[model samples]
Target: MMIGELFDPQAPLAISEHYRPHWSQAGAIVFITFRTADSIPYEVLQRWEREKNEWIARNTGRNADWRKVLPELDPRLRHQFKKTFNRLREDFLDTCNGKCVLRQPDFASIVADSLSHFDGKRYRLGDFIVMPNHVHLLASFPSEETMIGQCDSWLHYTAWKINQQLGNKGKFWQQEPFDHLVRSPEQYQYLCNYIRDNGTKANLRSGDFLYRQHDNHQ
Candidate 1:
């Protein structure tokens, strides 16, 4: 018996449909992407970032210019810009309306909060990045606790939190998630690159850069 073998030889092979890392061994590095149910324009995200940057610059007194004026912008304008921006951006990316990652404050926050479920229960979160539309994460757990059911629970719980915050009333995420067991150093590096580059896609990375990485330990 190997440390990472979950499939049965007698069963039919089903690979392309989804990626499921065998968790019998050290653990796996999972790359999960969650798009909006109908590709809603999430321009509010980018606009918010720009505003935040301007505010940071002003508060820090970093060679002020128009930024000095930015801080004083009327609250009404700020709200209006966020509202219109979101309609222009996320509306296009909110495909499926099921997993509207952009609908949330920071897609990463959804995953981070979901970790609470396993806080004192089971499993541990590893490295992760939350892009506009998806997330790449490394999670570890005792072999016994790594059952597929638990995976669903984690994702499902996160979706609920995200939907509640976004004032959504339907499915907030895709049903299936991609997973891959961390087998070798090369594989780990490859995954890390993919996660970090997630923002460059000109798509979901459209969200907040407030990405956070859980420790890479058990």
Candidate 2:
């Protein structure tokens, strides 16, 4: 149930396949970054998809053995790949897409309420900023049993509610979200700082981003 168990060199870690490797552990604090459907430029997304597919093919070679090979891979290489990809993605999100619907106060308020609806119930929510086209959150699940399901439910409901408000049947958010487990207090604090300053970095006005927290603030 601890983050240490997930990072132990000798231990077998649980990983899920996504755009990148997703590592999960029971009762861990995780930082999540998700964006709207139009958040990334089409060209950038196409390139990212191609690169990721090539990396997967090189590493796993169209086989299930990738699971076995994952843990044996060098940690530094994996960390660097993830870090570089995140930086690129964040940079893309910074450029203003004037069509950002969440910039509207009403739409932003909807997302904020959706995020906090299950606070202290499904997960202990931490500091979260609802930006114009994306959101960053620090959430710790009550247990591993509920991690994936609860996470999916939160995204699904929030997207549904937002779409309803928009009166469109189209997608509201991206299909894949970036999730990283906070391995240390230092990492957690860094994520907190990042969320707090996300608006400034994106050149957002004061009213553009909304942050909500309860007593369980990070």
Query: Per-residue CA lDDT of candidate 1, range 115-172, in tens?
Result: 5456425655555665555555665555533545566686678778777876877765
Instruction: Pick the TM-score winner.
Output: 2
Q: Which candidate gets the maximum lDDT versus the true structure? A: 2
**lDDT for each candidate structure:** 0.50, 0.72
lDDT for 53 (candidate 1): 62
Report the Cα lDDT for residue 11, model 1: 35
Q: How far does residue 88 in candidate 2 sit from its true spot (Å)? A: 0.5
Q: Which segments of model 2 are wrong by more than 4 Å?
A: 1-13, 18-21, 49-73, 213-218
